[model samples]
Target: MRDIKIIWDFRGPAALKTAEHHAIHLKEYAANCAIEYTTIDIQTFNEFYTIAFIVVKEKDMLSVRDALKPHRAEVYIKKRRD
Candidate 1:
C-alpha cells in the first residue's frame, strides 16, 4: 500500500494542545478501520503553530479525510475561476 499524508494545522496560544487533541480524534476515527495510520505533530515556527498528520495508505485517503473534516482541516483542490 502506498503511503499518503493528511495534515491538520493549528495556530494560536494553544496550538500544540489543539493539534494533539485533533490527533486523538483522528486516531479514534481510524480505530477498526482497514487503514494503518500514525498520528504525529510538527512544531512550525516557534511553538505557536503545530501541524498534526496521519500517514496512511493511499487507498484510505477518503477515510482519513472524513476524520479530518470536523476540524475543517481537509484539504480541498480549488478550481481557478480563470
Candidate 2:
C-alpha cells in the first residue's frame, strides 16, 4: 500500500504543546471521518522545534490535507509499493 506522511513543524515557545495540539486535530479529524492513520509528535533539541506527523493512505491525502489546512508546514510525503 502507498502511504503519505504529512508533517508539520512548530518552533518557538511551547513548541511541543503546539505540535501535540495539531496532532489532536488530525486524530479528531480521522475519527470523525472514519479514516485510519498514524500520528507522532517529536521534540528536536538542537534548535528547539516540534514535529507532527500524520500517516495516511494515498487515497486519503486530500481529506487529511483539507482537515489540516489551518496550520500547514514542512509537508514530507512517503510512498512504498511492494
Per-candidate TM-score against the hidden true structure: 0.67, 0.70
- In the range 1-82, model 1's lDDT, one tens digit per residue, is 5566677778888988887887777677677565575444444655787877776666778776775563334432334998
- TM-score of model number 1: 0.67
Worst 10 residues of 1 by lDDT: 70-79
Give the alpha-carbon lDDT of every model: 0.65, 0.69
Clashing pairs in 2: none
Q: 1-82, model 2: which lDDT tens digit per residue?
A: 5666777778887787877788887777778889887554454554568777777777777877786763453444544788
Cα RMSD (Å) per model?
7.6, 4.3
How many clashes (backbone N, Cα, C below 3 Å) per candidate? 0, 0
